[model samples]
Target: MDNTRLPLLSTETPLRADAVRNRARLLEAAARLSAEHGAAAITMESVAAAAGVGKGTVSRRFGDRNGLLQALLDHAEQGFQASFLSGPPPLGPGADPAARLRAFGPALLHHQRANRDLYLAAEPAPDRRFLVPAGRLRHTHVAVLVRAILPDADADLLAHTLLSSVDVVLVDHLLRGHGMSLDRVEAGWHDLVDRLLP
Candidate 1:
C-alpha cells in the first residue's frame, strides 16, 4: 500500500503531522507490546491496535515490518543511552571512574534483561563480513572515564574491548545459559577491571 493512502505529511508540502504522530504512537505501542509479549508475537496489527490506529496507518508511519523492527531497536538504544547517561549512579555519573566503569557492564546487562525483545530485535545478522565498528564518540566517553583510573593505559582499546563485554547476548549466555547470577557477573566484571587496570 502507498504511504500516501495513510495521510499526507502536511497540507502545504503534503506531509501529515498526524501521521507522524501516529507513527511515533505505533512505535511506543510496539515497545510495550514486545516487552509484555515477545518480539515474535509483536505484529504491525498489534501495534496499530494498541496505538488506536489502522494497520495501514502503522505501515505508512514505518514503511514495513523491517522499519517497525528498526524503529523499535532505535528506541531501545536511545533508552540505553539515556539510562546510562542520566538514570542513576553507579550506572550514571555520580560514581568514580573505577566504580562507574565497573557498574556500566552490569547495568547494561540488567537493562538488556528488562528489554530483551527490543535488544533481540535490534541485533544484526551474523553474516556481515565486518563487525560493527565502535562509535568514536562513545569510545571517547568511555576513554575519558577509564583514563582517570589508569592514567597510563590505552583507554581507546580498553574501552573498545571492554565495552563489548556489556552486550546482552553474551551476558544472557554467561548467566542464564550458565546458571550464574547477576552478582556473579558483577563480581567478574570487577575482577577483570582490576586485572586490566592496576
Candidate 2:
C-alpha cells in the first residue's frame, strides 16, 4: 500500500501549544475514564468533570459523543500504525515481506488486546465496519504484502481472511468465551501464515 494511505494524526493540524495540551488532557481524561469505568460511562459531562473542564470545552473539542469516541480511537490507533509503518524491523520496513507478514498478526493482536474496550465500544455497524479508515489502511497493507508473497493468489480476499482471523470481536470471543490464550491465538496466526506460504 502507498504510505499516503495511512491515517493522519490529529496533531497534523497546526494548533497553539495550549490547544495541543488541552486536547491531550481531554483525551487522557477520556481514556482514563474508559479504562476505569467503561466506554459507556464516558460522556462529555463525565470527561469534563474528570478533566476539570467545562462541558462546553468538551463539546468544543469533540462536538459530540460519537466524534469524541472516533477521535479517541484515532488517538489510540496512531501509535500502532506508526510502529508498523515506520518503526524498526520485522513489523516495520526493514524485514523481508514474509517476516513482516508473520509479524503483523501478533503486533495487531497485542494492539487490539491493549485497546479492546475502545475497539469493542467503537465497533461500527455491520455495514460500515470494513469501511472505517483504520480498517481500510490495514486491509490495504495486508493486501499489498499478500500480493508480494503470493503472486497468483487473490490478495484482497486473502488479506481479509488473515485479518478476520484476529479481528477484535473474534479475539475477544476466543479469549473470553472460549478460554483461549493470546499466545495460542497468535500461534494460530503464525500457522495460518505458514500454511499460505508456497
Candidate 3:
C-alpha cells in the first residue's frame, strides 16, 4: 500500500483553537455520558447539559446525533490509528511485518473493548460498513502486512479473513454471550497468525 497516496477521510476545514477546545470538551462530556449510561443515552440536549453548554453549541459542533456519534467514534479511533501507523515497536512501523500483524489483533481487541458502546452505536449499515474510511485504512494496513509476510498469498482476502476474526461485534459476542475471556480471544489471534505464517 502506498501510504503517501492514501486518501484522507476528512474534508472539514481546520477549527480555531477555542473551537477545538470546545469540541474536545463536548466530546468528553458525551464520552462520560456514554460511559455512565449508554450510547443510546447520548443526545444533543444530554451532552449540552452534561458539558454545561447550550444545545446550540453541541449542534454547531457536531451537526446532529449521528454526526456526534461519528465524531465520538473518530475521536476514539485516532489514538489507535496513530499507534499502528506511526508509534513505536510491535504494533507500529519499527517491527517486522509478522510481529506487527500478530500485535494488531490484540491491540484492536483492546481498542474496541474500550470503546465498545461508541463503536456499537456508530456501527455503519451493512452496505456502508466496508466503505468507512477507518475500516478501509485498516484493511489496507493489514493487506500490506500480509503481502510482506507471504508474498505469494492472496493478501487481500487473507487480510479480510484475519481482520474478521477479531471484529468487534464477533468479539463482543464471544466475550458476552459465549463467556470467552479476552486472553483466550487474543490467543486465538496469535494462533491464527502462527498458522498462517507457518
lDDT of 2 by residue, 1-198 (tens): 676745454455555567779989999899888877878888999999999999999998899998998888898789889988888989999998899999999999988886788899888999999999999999999998999999999999999999999999999999999999999999999999999998
| Residue pairs whose backbone atoms clash in candidate 3 | none
Between 1 and 2, whose lDDT is larger? 2
Clash numbers, per candidate: 8, 0, 0
Candidate 3 positional error at 126, Å: 2.3
Residue-by-residue lDDT tens digits, candidate 1, 1-198: 687855443453534556566667787888888777878767888888898878888877778787888788777667778766787888678888887887777766666776776565566677631254323444666788889998898887888777666666777788778998878877777788878777
Instruction: List TM-scores for all candidates, in order.
Output: 0.76, 0.81, 0.83
lDDT digits (tens) for residues 1-198 of candidate 3? 777544442333344667899999999898888867878889999999999999999999999999999998998789899999999979999999999999999999988987888888777899997988999999999999999999999999999999999988899899999999999999999999999994
Q: Give the alpha-carbon lDDT of every model.
A: 0.73, 0.91, 0.91
Q: Please give me the total number of clashing residue pairs in predicted model 1.
A: 8
> What lDDT score goes with residue 62 in model 2?
94
Of the two candidates 2 and 3, the one with more favorable TM-score, higher being better, is 3
Give every collision pair in model 2: none
Q: Residue 64 deviation, candidate 2, in Å? A: 3.6
Candidate 3 TM-score to native: 0.83
